[model samples]
Target chain A: MTNSNSFPAIDQDGYLLSRTDWNPAIARQLAQAEHIELTANHWEIIELVQEFYREFELSPASRALVRYTQQKLGNDKGRSIYLMGLFAPHPALLVSKIAGLPRPANCF
Target chain B: MKSLLCISRHSPYGTAIAREALEAVLAAAAFEQNIALLLMDDGVWQLKDQQQPIAGIQKSLARNLNALEMFGVDTVYAHQPSAQKRGLNTAELCIESIEWLDDDQVRQLISNHDHLLSF
Candidate 1:
């Protein structure tokens, strides 16, 4: 199963082969396949995720994301529902996809 | 992976909690658990930058923290009040970029983890 629009080559699980390969175009294409329209909130999470990887050298899992977001973005934007709204069902998976981060290790 | 928070409440050297908590964290990370390490109370002393080896009693505590990052334990934190009580500052910590949290944030950190282990 592949997208009609060519995406920058990703791994079998939809993770980018190289972090440098990610950009806005790649993010938009990924979100489109997930039936999502990228909003400001989506981009916020995406940005935070990349920064997290840079700082921690690992993708933030769901619970870690909630804590980090709560500290940085405030309580309203940090809960599971807010993340689920932007990237439903599997917020960690979807957020990492859009952020061009590696699939969060524990996401599956 | 289960989110495991290892809370170290005792300082290094005096007791085994420092090394014990670190060992548990390493084990959890080896299991591919999402692990967070929080230094509270006397535990904040573990992050103090320079410590000479305690004769033959203990290995360098700094080495343990560095090993933690390599072991895949990414979220290292220190409780603010705890550090302040001990007159410690984040800038002088052995681990680079350790998150400093107040009591409220510490409570939130606790709630974020699936498992809590205290040492």
Candidate 2:
């Protein structure tokens, strides 16, 4: 089933309506909610961050995200400023939500 | 408004301790509380320029630091010795808004606050 216009139930923040019901389409919609267009780079970071959660069972905060990104994506793409621009407003929160994962612990 | 001093004494990137503390500060400010954020010891590292936490799959802690001022948290402080220990000066700090404090001033700062919260 595709989400037509109605998004699933998310918390006050635009996270996930149903954690398990995540599809690529849902991520696009979620990004739309934040007014961000998911570019190729955006998808790369989002997917990698989600993979981080799967591997570690925890959402990587800003610090962890940078290190992991550097390792997998290379040093250039791992910059904090670049990530901030992509996930503007709230990077960890938006990235986690876009990736169909829960909020990172210890994130403000 | 209650006077609150929040001491952030953790390294900037290892964990979310500093960010969590910053959230607490922002929340306090939203409630119209008089809040002061202090970065001391290793926490001073949070203010270093050229931080790149995103590659680690995290967000920038510096952005939260910048947001504190907008929340009316104008009284920000960093330990002088802590900054110096890392060979850092105010110019090298990500936040130039914060004042540097010495031991005596730190003591006075503690007394000035009605409640002191450590992060």
Candidate 3:
């Protein structure tokens, strides 16, 4: 079963379980896969994923995930360009992979 | 090639966001780019069987979705959870039935696509 504390720390075998355990190695992998360099915004998204998991028992949907960040960082920071820059696909999926929860449904 | 993915997460008449998203999708399709539309969360209500626009407040968006196929935009998907949340069934909606996608699937779709433009 999935829970708030399910995600493993950045160390250990967390990377195998969840992409959110992004260490330098995993970050490099993500950067290569998405064909873009990692930036602070990317880290911000990963951090937001962790924060979201702590708040909502379940992983957020794409919109909720964005709104959650908007509520936290203000509207300017919550824009899709900024959010998308961090999570190539959708914020929820990116966060879920990192949060160690099952990917969100309906993002496609 | 540029591909546009439009994700709608609000209900019609509930807010202007939903209508705006639909309009954006239509506009993208008009540009002759590959476009896919995903309706999730409260956005699924836009596809509900019968949607009556609240008087003169706004126009019903159901027809716009129904016309997607004619515009050469056939890919439409809705989250199963969203559908169940509002007790919506595919048959009730006028648009073509969409395959329900899970989180992992959605992730893969987004990653594989060239450009994802969500509304």
Quote each prediction's TM-score: 0.53, 0.56, 0.49
Assign candidate 3 its CAPRI class: incorrect
Give per-residue CA lDDT, model 2, range A1-108, as digits (tens): 645676677767666745677889989988898899999989999889877765544566666676678778888877778789899977877899888887765567
Tens digits of lDDT, candidate 2, B2-119: 6899999998778889988987886676566788998899999889987766654786777667656545578789899888888876787677678889988988998998999899
Per-residue lDDT of model 1, residues B1-119, tens digit only = 67789999998888777988877876677567788999999999998987776644566777657646545677789899988887796678777778889999999999998999989
Residue lDDT tens for model 3, B1-119: 77777888887875689878876776666555687888888888887866666644555577557645544567787777778867887677756667788777777777877876665
Model 1 DockQ reads 0.02
Which candidate wins on TM-score?
Answer: 2
Cα deviation at A20, candidate 3, in Å, is: 58
Winner of 1 and 3 under lDDT:
1
Candidate 3's C-alpha lDDT? 0.64
Better of 2 and 3 by TM-score: 2
DockQ winner between 1 and 2, please give it: 2
What is candidate 2's CAPRI-style docking category based on DockQ?
incorrect
Which 10-residue window of candidate 2 chain A scores lowest in summed lDDT?
A: A54-63
Off by over 4 Å in 1: A1-6, B1-92, B96-119
Q: Lowest summed lDDT over 10 consecutive residues: which window, candidate 3 chain B? A: B63-72
DockQ of each: 0.02, 0.04, 0.01
